[model samples]
Target: MDGDLRGWRQCLLSGAVFAVCMAGTTLPTPLYGLYQEKFDFSELTVTVVYAVYAVGVIGVLLLAGNASDAVGRRPVLLWGLGAATASAVCFLFATTLGWLYVGRLLSGLSAGLFTGAATAYVMELAPHGGTSRATFLATAANMGGLGCGPLLAGVLAQYADWPLYLPFAVHLALVACSAAVLLRLPETVRERRPLRTVRPQRPGLPPRVRSVFGPAAAATFVGFALFGVFTSVSPSFLAHSLDVRNHAVSGLIVALAFFASTAGQLAVGRFGLGRSLPLGCAALLGGLALLAGALWWDLLPLVVLSALVGGIGHGLAFRGSLAVVAAASEANQRAAVISALFVVAYAGISVPVIGVGLLAGPMGLEGAGLVFIACMMLLVSTAGVYLLRRPAPAAETAGQP
Candidate 1:
């Protein structure tokens, strides 16, 4: 009983550590406007800076996605924390565009390392028969941590001292504390191999996985793209179009989306597997419509509504996609297929963001957003159609998983 108690406690503590690392990733979301003012840059540059983080995440995912499995979770997470610290330091000393770029890149590296390693650690630390609850904890901590970052930074930047420097400073302190907690915990991976033996999992789908991976990847892609645009440029839009200047307000609006997604993920338990993806796609189409309404009517309420509906759709689609993908594969091929899905998801995040940036210059931010919404609507609609025609095999056991 005591050992099981200890196991659960450690798992929660590890979730906290995971949360902290994720918080650092979005700490800059609300501050991008201030950076633009200080550096005198365009919306395109902001997108570039934001997209660079995705690049770093994808690069690491492709190259060392499974390093923790070989060298053990603690070492990989410790390195992740180190990268997060470096990112904070870069932001602290950021006097130039170059520093912003470096900070975002390092933040991405930290997240890329933490996403898989920390999740695995949290689950592994669970006591027997605790996987279900542990999965929820791992996911909630991730989204909650992300939501907290912008809220924290926004409040501080809006009302407190040194808007730019203080947030990163606070994050650095949190990172230091997280490192202490992590170091004191025992290593979860017992039979570790040397680091040199690790190789890139090189994402691929076997023939059996292709059918399931297709629509799942598409849904995942559109969902991530929605979030990427929201985080990367929506602040600028709020200030320019809605004339909403409160940093705290902007941050909260963005945070609402993430929080909504968390709620949506919890709601997935009520859905059967086949229904979740198709219904999720339907929800996504509705979200895209809300976004279109926001743009067409020039209404802030519509934007907020879009965030809520889209976030729910994102959560539902992502969880359903994961379950379906996991169910489709033989046990041996499951992990690699999931990694390939990550690659595609990350691609959706980075690539379209750049396109939006490129369009914002000529079409204007509002115009660019409309274009993005149009493109995503088509993609999501296609995915919805695909899922309705042929649900993934895992759909039958989704809620159970």
Candidate 2:
């Protein structure tokens, strides 16, 4: 009993650490408007800046996704925290557009490292027979932390003294505390190798995983694309279209999707993985439709609904996607396969967002959003139908090691 309690405690502590690191990644979400005003940049510049973080994340996932498995979780996480600290510092002292780009890139690197390593670390810390709960905690901490980022930054930026500087300052302090907490936690990987042995993880999947990976990756892409739009441009849309310039309101609106995603992740166990994937796709389609309505009608309530619905869809699809992929892969191939999925997911965040920014120049934000939604709706619908016809074989037994 004592051991189990200790295990749970460690797992929760690890979750807290995970939360802190991720929160830094999104701390700049609400403040992008302020940066634009100070820097005199366009919306296209904002998307490019936001997308740079995804570029960094994808680069890390491709190059060093499995680093923790080799050198141990603590070292990789500590390095991630270091990167996060650098990102915060960059933001704190950002006077030039170049600084924001660098900060986002480092922030991406921090997230890329933490995503795989921290998820694995949290699950490993749990006692036996606690995998399901651990998975929930791991994912919940991830989404919850992401949600807090915008909220924290928006609130601080609104009421605090330094709108641009203070949020990153607070995040720096949080990162330092997280580093200290991480140092006290035990390393979970027992057979650690030297850092020199770590090689870049090329994206590859077994033949059997392809069938499951396809629709799952598609859902993941659309889900993340939805998030990319919300985080990157929703604030701008709210400010320009609705004339809702309150930073706290903008941040809370953006945070809603992530919070809803956490809630959606919690429903996966009840829905079952097989059902969750298709259902998630269905929900995503509905969310996209809601977003279209929000864009077309310029309704504030519609935007809020879109965030809630879309966030739930993202959570359900992403968690279900991760579990399905994990269950289908061999133990030796699990990390690589998961990394590949994230690469695709992060690509969704970057590529499509840049596309929206480009179109935002010609078509306007609402027009560009509708076009993006139309395309995503079509893609997600196709994926949904495919899943309904042929669900992943591993879904029923997912989360079992």
TM-score of each: 0.98, 0.96
Clash counts for the predictions, in order: 0, 0
Residue pairs whose backbone atoms clash in candidate 2: none
lDDT of candidate 1 over 210-304, digit per residue (tens): 88888889999998898888888888988888898899988988888888888878888887665778777887888889988887788999889
Residues 12-115 of candidate 2 have per-residue lDDT tens digits of 99999999999999899988889999999988999999999999999998988889999999999999999999999998988799999999999999999999
Q: Give every collision pair in model 1.
A: none
**Model 2 residue-pair collision total:** 0
Best by lDDT: 2
Against the true structure, what is every candidate's RMSD?
1.2, 1.6
Question: lDDT of each prediction vs. the true structure?
Answer: 0.89, 0.92
* Residue 380 in model 1: lDDT: 90
Which TM-score value belongs to model 1?
0.98
Worst 10 residues of 1 by lDDT: 392-401
